[model samples]
Target: MTVRGAGIFGLACAHACATRGARVRVIDRAGIAAGASGGVVGALAPHTPDAWNAKTAFQLVALLEAEAYWAGVDARSGISSGYARLGRLQPVADDRALSLARAREASAAGLWQGRAEWRVVRAKAGWGPVSPTGWLIHDTLSARIAPRAACHSLAGAIRDLGGEIVIGEGAEAGAVIDATGHDGLAALAADTGRPAGTGVKGQAAVFGLDRRDAPQVFADGVHIVPHADGTVAVGSTSETEFADPTATDALLDDVIARAVAYCPELAGAPVLARWAGVRPRARSRAPMLGPWPGRPGRYIANGGFKIGLAMAPACAGLLADLVLEGRDAIPEAFRVEASL
Candidate 1:
């Protein structure tokens, strides 16, 4: 099978197909993790535990199995994806938010299938966010993976599995999977003469801090993810309109300030890197997966949006099922037709 784009979606799908004994080839004009997947922050955070549905359920399954999936990639590749399931912490801004959080504890208990817990706890110092309400919601389901490293790890695994990765261009052979991300979305929009999907620009910064063992923090819509490589990443600003998708500006400065404000311990950390990228967001605001409507032997795996890294493993599996085994296991909400 041939997969287009070397971002998390394409690489993971290529790896999945190889695992299933399918010879695979991946073509990416830009090298691995050359887009959103190359960004600084990698937060495998879960959706709110309340109001559980197929989408959230799908993410849950992915988050729960992420450790094993990434570990296999790491083992096969002999490269660490920097994956860690250290969970996440979110500050409660007020009584109302706290009430909702506590309520979700009940829902998460049942909805999460006892595999994880969502509970409110007294906010603690050091490795935590500032909470005016003195409370925080901590859930065990959230995890982190180094975005670039994960893609490289998967590439190595694919190579180990005897799959081919063609940079720049390659002839299309066998079933074709278009995980081309933003470009694919743009093509879809042009094809339908409607906004099927578009790029959402995001910016983030990395800090030189060894908080690898700490749970990630989500405060005031900002994510502070601590990777296994001793660096902490904090970001980002979701801008639907931007002059330059790859340019980082003052918006990132604000996020760094907010991250430091949320976790005071990061006040003096060295500014390691600032990065910007565009993510593919479908019109349905969910994963866009399925065959091209009128194009046989072609499949799509895009629309991961803010959750691409988090959702890649499970979404890749579902796409591989359809492409390699002729099985359709994708949820309707995540289908390409949904975007159409």
Candidate 2:
């Protein structure tokens, strides 16, 4: 099968196809991770308690499967993308927040496999060493990936497997996987009759800080992820319906201020770089995967929103299983037909 668009989802599909004994060719207009996947830090945390049952189930399986997949990739070939299971911390800002956290803790414990790994802590007096005035739920299941590096590694793996990756504009293929992200469906003309997904712009900055200065990872409204190169990645702002992929001063200020507030060590960090990308967010907040309703041989695995990196491995596996092995059992939430 010929796969077009060698982004995260496309490359993942290509890898899966090659593994499943299918001849594959991946084509992309721009380089890998050129869309939302190009961001500095890609968090692999799945849904919270707010997600629906089907969505939660899919993410749970996907997250677990991705752990094994990344381990395999790391062992067979070195992955320099700084993949770390640093866990996640959802702080309780207030009393209402604390209640919500408690509920989430209960729900997540019941749903997640490693229940004992999650803990809820109380806040202390001072903010320095003291915790917030809420609960701290630390789940070991969450992970992080250096987006660009992972994308490069995946592309390299696709080539290493003897699959072809064509980089040019307006390339053609027998079957195309629209993993180009926010730009993907638009590039494809949306002839498949599926509801066009919405775009959300996110801006983030990479800061060069001492290794000891930054935390492994801290996420609230904004997230801070430390890289192996003594650089801490801080982001991101969610702007709905924004098409421009350029960084803005307002976003930078907000993120920096928030990052320093969350982690005081980064108060005076040197800014390295700043950029932005548009994420394809599905209207129903679920990914669309499978062939175009009426257009045969064309498939879409885009609209992963902010969790594309965490969700790609499983999504790709499912898509390949459907296309190659004639599997019909897709997670009900991710069924493209429902959205169509």
Candidate 3:
């Protein structure tokens, strides 16, 4: 199988196919992790436990399946993908938020199938986001992984499984899957003469805080992720209009300020790296998967949007199942036709 675009989705699909005894070659015009998947902040957070639907349920399955999947990749690749189920912390700003968290505790019990827990707890000191109401939502299902490292590790695993990652374009030798992030989605939008999806630019920054063991914090529309390398990541500014997709500026600084305001412990951390990337966001704002409509021998695995990393595992599995075994377990909402 030839997978185009060597980002998380493409490499993940390639790894899945190669591990299943299919020869795979990944070709990307800009090389691996050259898109949004190469960004610094890698949070595998799930949607709110309320108003559960197919999209959130599918994300739940993917979040639960991520640890073992990435662990297998790290083991086979002999490289650390910086993957850990460290969980996540979210602040409860007021009574209404606390009430919702308490309600979700019951909902998650039923929805998570006893695999994970989402409960309201007292806010911890020295770490975790400060809750104005003294309560926080702690969900054990949330996890984090280094995006670029995970891609490299997936590439390593693919090579170990007898696949190749090549630079530049190549003819499709077998089943071709389009996992090209923003570019592929844009092409689709142009070809269909309608809005399929567009890129949403985001900027993030890495901090020098060595809080690898701390749970990721999501507060004020910002994510504070602690990587395994002892660095903390604070991000991001989602911009639909940006002149430069890869430039960091005041928008990122604003994100850092918000992170610091949420967690005072990070106020002293030095900024290490700043990054910006454009994520592929479909019109449905859900994954656009399955065989590409009206395009024989080609499939789409794009439109991951904000949850691309969180959704990669299940997306790869379902798409690989469709491409390899002629089975389709994709959710109705994630079908390519839905995005079209």
lDDT per prediction?
A: 0.92, 0.71, 0.91
Instruction: Give lDDT: candidate 1, residue 88.
Output: 93
TM-score of each: 0.98, 0.89, 0.98
Cα lDDT tens digits, model 1, 1-340, are 7999999999999999999999999999989999899987899988898777889989999999999999899999999999989989999999999899999999999999999999999987678999999999999989889999999999999999999999998999989999999999998778767778889999999899998899999998899998877789998999999999899999999999999999998998998998999999999999999998778898899999999999998999999889877899889899898888
lDDT of 2 at 148: 84
Q: Write the per-residue lDDT of candidate 3 for residues 38-125, one digit (tens) a residue.
A: 9999999988887889999888889888988988999999988899998999999898888888989999999899999998999877
Give the TM-score comparing model 2 with the true structure, all chains together: 0.89
Candidate 2 residue-wise lDDT, 24-110, digit = tens: 888777767777777886777766655658777877787777666776655544656567666666555678767777787777777
Clashing pairs in model 3, backbone N/Cα/C closer than 3 A: none
How many clashes show up in model 1? 0
Q: With candidate 1 superimposed using the best TM-score fit, by how many Å does residue 338's alpha carbon deviate from the native?
A: 0.5
**Model 3 bad stretches (over 4 Å):** none
Write down the lDDT that model 3 would get.
0.91
